[model samples]
Target: MDVWKLNLRHLRSVAMTVRLGNLKAVAKKINLSQPAVTQSIIKIEEWFGAQFFVRHPSGMHPTEFANVLSPRIEMALNLIGSNRVTSTQARAFLSLSKTGSYVAASRDIGISQPSLHRNVADLQSVLNFKLVEPRGRGIALTPKGISVARKFLLARLQLEAGFSEIYALLGKETGHISIGAMPLSRASLLPSVLVAFQKRHPHITISVVEGGHGELIEPVRDGHLDIIIGAIREHPIGKDLIQIPLFTDQPVVIGRKDHPLTKVFEKNACCQNSQIMKLAHYPWYMPGKGAPINVVWRELFNRVPVDIPNIPIMGGSVMMIRQLLLETDGLTLLSPDQVAVELEADWLVQICTVPEWMQRDIGITYRTNWHPTRAQSYLLELLNHHSRK
Candidate 1:
């Protein structure tokens, strides 16, 4: 169901009916006439093609569908944080906030610019807050507007989840999980889990968006992504986000198969300080600063009292780093799992493993308040099972 098209007032009435258990009470609570509340319930039930309330002589009793969907509706209403905001106003402001221009928002939403402006203005008037302001060419949201937008997006996610759960209850598989994948997760961990998950739940849709942690964190926080998989951060991020460690990935120094370091490791079983110092002469390829591997590289060289190797390229692209390693005498610190194919193909060789203390925790990050549907929970279970293997 396209949740944005549904009336917020009707949905709120549904939630209130679940709580109050009678149309008269629900109508009084929401300031609607009893017949209007009855009509609202009828409309919602018709839209879903299911009965939410079982009418009785005593009062209206909720059916199983209502029991499953009511909590989600409540959560969504709480996130929206207002009783006066209509679905049209929410849609209009969200469109404007996303496109950042009245003209573009109108074009995207298929409404005239004046109508879009009026809708947004009505929204701001109801909330009594400044949402947008004129920029050089377009408009920008105020800080308060951005916060409200995040909450509205989260509310939308909740409504979608509610309907998806309803579909599941009716023996329909229609859940979606959006993932933000970092470089390490993309190589093997995520693919294996996804394959296993798809086999078990073929109808569920899975989307994997690849990017660095810095680029993906905000989207996940804003409900655009369900979760992010990668190396866990060293310090505390905040209470709003939670991390689950799936496994620990040890860092390894890697180079092209025929590089000079391959010969150095061939003769020595253990890498000593001298062997480590030998790495100072070659150009290095590291991920951008603050990456787990980059931090380990800095620590490894800092302990040797040798000048840090010059880094010619800094990025998180494993393919690009592999090509650079094969073309030049450049070494990189990375998880061996990230380049398993290259190692198997004899294109790259692990020169030495970093100390066990240097191992980083690889895992999943998600919002603290997120309530995963059954399908999402199943995928997370698959990820944990595959990561352990």
Candidate 2:
């Protein structure tokens, strides 16, 4: 199932084969020829951009991706019950789910209630499942029907983007790109690049979402995000991701303008081991688990191979650290670029010298198999240019 070949049939076929564990059994159950089932499985592989099944002499087995996604997707598809659905039916089903009543849906769609009900009934017939239940003056989707609606809605969004991209490629207009912004990129690089990009491609809609690594990473894996950009880890990022290194942001210990350390550094202007060891005396602000800044903090300890004395505050809240440091003598390790505003205003001063090894690799990560369209490629190049500068 390449771009054009992807359809409900192929999706259902692969799902059934995974559940039944053999091509022959799946074909018999679905009443399709074995050769047809084989082609459907292949189509599913192409659509998913990965092989989801392993064929052996004994039987067929689901791959790891299949094992993970199969249950969730299967639950959704089971509501439809079969693969026979038209675009009109899909649209009506989707819209009906939203409006929740044939009268309201018909009014919104600018059609008669009878016509809307007929269309929904047609969809129900094609799916071989009852999708809605009337209660009071409105209706609600069944549990399985809600699952089906969710899957189709996701598919519709993908199709909308796909068609928009196709239109752009064919010299028509309209497109949308979803980009995930990580902590570092959100501060400067991503915003600067997006401004430049919007100037060039004004009609292409761009949506930017922000979160930490744990929150952002899985959305890209599930095809909900086009790309994620930020200060990245050098160690193994998951197998599903392809990270492109853009820049290196060094981590420096920073404190308030009038802190004791700033006064001491101003007089001495040196980062001797003795001065570094004195960091234990002052209050410390530690990075949270799994943050890129945490990695840089860990690198500091790994190189020095010693434990610091005081760690009263340990979390990843930027505002809290900024205020606490401004009011007290607490210290924190962070990428200089993240606080460029504070640095430029002289509100925050660097205390310890950042070592050469204490840098986070800033970059973009996308799904490994994703091939960008013209709009996406243009943004990627813009990011590349900004990161280099």
Best-matching candidate per TM-score: 1
lDDT of candidate 1 over 275-336, digit per residue (tens): 77888889998888878778877888788778889998888898999999999999988888
Give Cα-based local distance difference scores for all models: 0.88, 0.73
248-303, model 2: which lDDT tens digit per residue?
88777888888887656654244555666667568877666578677666556545
What residue pairs are clashing in model 2? 1-43
TM-score of 1: 0.96
**Candidate 2 local Cα displacement, residue 241, angstroms:** 2.0
Residue ranges of candidate 2 with Cα displaced over 4 Å: 1-158, 169-172, 266-272, 309-311
How does candidate 2 score on lDDT? 0.73
